[model samples]
Target: MQPLTAYCMRGHRQVEGWLQRGSLSILWSLLEAQRLHALAGDVAEIGVFHGKLFIALALSLTNEERAVAVDLFEMKRAPDFEQEFRSNLEQFSVPMDRVDIRRCASEMIALSAAPEIFGSNVRLFSVDGSHEYAAVIHDLNLARACISQVGIIALDDLFSAWSPGVSEAAIDFLRHPDNRDIVPLAISAAHGPLITGASKLFMVHASQVDFYASELMRMNRQSFKTRASFCGVKTLVFDFTNGVRKRIEFR
Candidate 1:
């Protein structure tokens, strides 16, 4: 596993967005580890509020890789979001050529010919778009369609009271037979007032669990020992002080 260096930590904090520092750390560490393991694929996100996390994904990409941003930028929920998104990316000096911004709802993008736009090699898919149950399920399906063999799909706000639907939808999707191939790797959450706080869930292929587990243990000693089983699925759950924890599971 690749260690989260000081420079990477600083870059994560420098980016402005809803992503907590700990979540950013985990994202950076995961991507770095993926790169080290030669898990080559494109990166993507569904709900880019501003270009904060999007920029982080962009920074992680190599010249041959691409990053896709899908969101209803001008919608009532976040008017002028695209403007800020563009500004932030520019401010961070992200290569505009490497990014493909899609201005539409996640459901719309999911229903379209997404693979043609984003390609079929998605190693990291971040689902932070709609908090509604149906929307979450749709996004997960889309993520599954494009995710590489060793790719990871990250679901945001899994346990946040503000969007309990996300958790319900994710659990439901996991239980469904159609999604049997998409297994959980870890659920990252922070220790906090349960309801208001949020958690991020990382998932991957069932066959890749041992690889991720070994790498995760190498990176964080505190994470390796904390294990649990859900619905017969074994998971490694890790909690951080900043209210960030990851529960990795396998089928």
Candidate 2:
């Protein structure tokens, strides 16, 4: 396995969260590619349950880049949520000084005030916060405002059986008259990009559609690939029918 894959796998297993194992390889591959292309910007994730995916993103950052983790950290089921999140970062040797932790509802914040909160030019944003329709729309707008030129938004629970609102909200968000320039790159489901184990839909600005779509195809890591319409935009779909593998490799 590649060193990134090994470390990501270790972190994914050790962390407490709801991320698919397959997502680690795909996320790491894309982030590394962004670095290779000199995409300099911060990374942010709303609703960081316990830093499972956040750690990998933070680790990928350059010395000048920062990672922001926004979460309410008050879920009844997740006792000591904030403490565990901090502990995980320390255990993984993440540079805590470079990470900004914000405790608030994502929708409560506005992008106009982002400079003080999220900074600017976010290259990669993970939108796993608030699966509700209105909240998803709000978060997407915020992401659109701060995304860098080569940025990609990773929206979790896109096709999840338990979170159908996520899919509804994504489609609704993209349909708005103001969002005509946004398009999806791929869906990390059984019928979409990457492999079958992930459950997020990756979207980007129309200008970036070809860039990410072509890159994912070039990777050639999917079991099957084809074209499909998601959120009213044409995109490449990759799927894996076999059970999760012991090891996954990304080109």
Candidate 3:
């Protein structure tokens, strides 16, 4: 696991958004690993603020794959956000033909024509839209419906003080009988001290736990000091030099 500095630094600096290097590294690793396993699917993000993480996803996509971005571009808080997002995408030379931009609230998109708009082959789904409990639940349900067999969903701002509802909603979804198949595979933190380190939690189908854990460990061996623990369930912790640690628990 070479420090994500080389892979993530350029995108992190070029795009102005909330995702930290550590979490971005994890996202890149997951996508790369999935590709290695010959997984076939597209990528998407619920809240594509300024296309920071969105651009990274776009760059990882194949010519046949699409990167869908859902957000309330002109209607919501950041009026100029959409402009900035396009500008950044253009600056990075992202292929507009393969990018699908939906300028609407995530809940609306989830309820309406999401299935037709986004096929059922989503490989990586990022949930960073409205942090409200109901919104999170809706987005999770949408992800469940659209994701592929080996797809991974990355939930942002989990357990953060600013949005306690995200944690509550995620727990609710996880506990629901209908969503039992979705389980947490790995957890990554944000960079810097201003925010709490832990920021994102990646999930996958219950059956693919071993594969996700092994692939993550193999790909990140250089950047993190890895250790395994058997506290009822197998747990792998990757402690990075920058103090951003990722824990993958087999629950």
Candidate 4:
């Protein structure tokens, strides 16, 4: 495989995944803001299909930081998904030792093992493991247990037509009395004909909501912006403009 030295939206598209183009910008903005705020921790993703988004998260790591990837790579359609995932990491210049790969179902992971497996300071945790309501809730609870004080959780398929269960699970998580500290920071939505449906919901500990929301607004000044009440908190909703969208188009 060819070597890659840097990570970009262009490079990320080359890897196969369901992540929307606009979501890439939002993830990058969150990661960048985390760095500016000096939040230090590991990054993890539950469903790492072919390492598409995982590769980007791994490349963002610094110093002793690591990335934990959880997935049942033995897919019925792609039996060799595990091999493909590792190959993509190598192609993207991510060191093998920097990643801790767990080949198991998300539900199989014990909540008690969260601290040892994910550590308590996971700065960014992506929950795309299973779209089923039960699985989504389980994965999200695991994320909450491992997330840092200011960490951001990226919950995927919240508004995807193919996965209505994911959205329902999100509501269940936010409504729980135990999850009162977690709040929606932003939601990716369709701004025009190019974008459609909200693809992801970004949540942060209540303490850092303002920080991330303001930072996102400052970074995305050129894009359309609006807000809506979600899970008892106002969330920043925006999409890329024609010019910004053109820049991320796969070449």
**Per-prediction TM-score to the true structure, in the order listed:** 0.87, 0.88, 0.85, 0.90
Counting clashing residue pairs in each candidate, in order, gives 13, 1, 2, 0
Q: By TM-score, highest first, what's the ranking?
A: 4, 2, 1, 3
**Per-residue lDDT of 222 in model 4:** 61
**Cα lDDT, model 2, residue 104:** 93
The residue-level lDDT of candidate 3 at 73 comes to 69
**Runs in model 4 with CA error above 4 Å?**
1-6, 190-198, 241-251
Candidate 3: the clashing residue pairs are: 1-222, 1-223
Off by over 4 Å in 2: 1-4, 190-198, 243-251
Candidate scoring better on lDDT of 1 and 2: 2
Please give the lDDT score for candidate 3: 0.74
243 in model 4: Cα distance from truth in Å? 5.3
Give the whole-model CA lDDT for all candidates, comma-separated: 0.74, 0.75, 0.74, 0.81
Instruction: Work out how many backbone clashes candidate 1 has.
Output: 13
Residue range 19-84, candidate 1, lDDT tens digits: 755556567667767867778899999988776677777877775999999988765755676888
**Over 4 Å off, model 1:** 1-8, 75-78, 110-112, 191-197, 223-225, 242-251
lDDT of 3 by residue, 51-149 (tens): 878887777677599989998865355555788888878877788899998888887764456667777899888988888999999998888888888
Which candidate wins on lDDT? Answer: 4
lDDT of 3 at 234: 42
Poorest stretch of ten by lDDT in candidate 3: 226-235
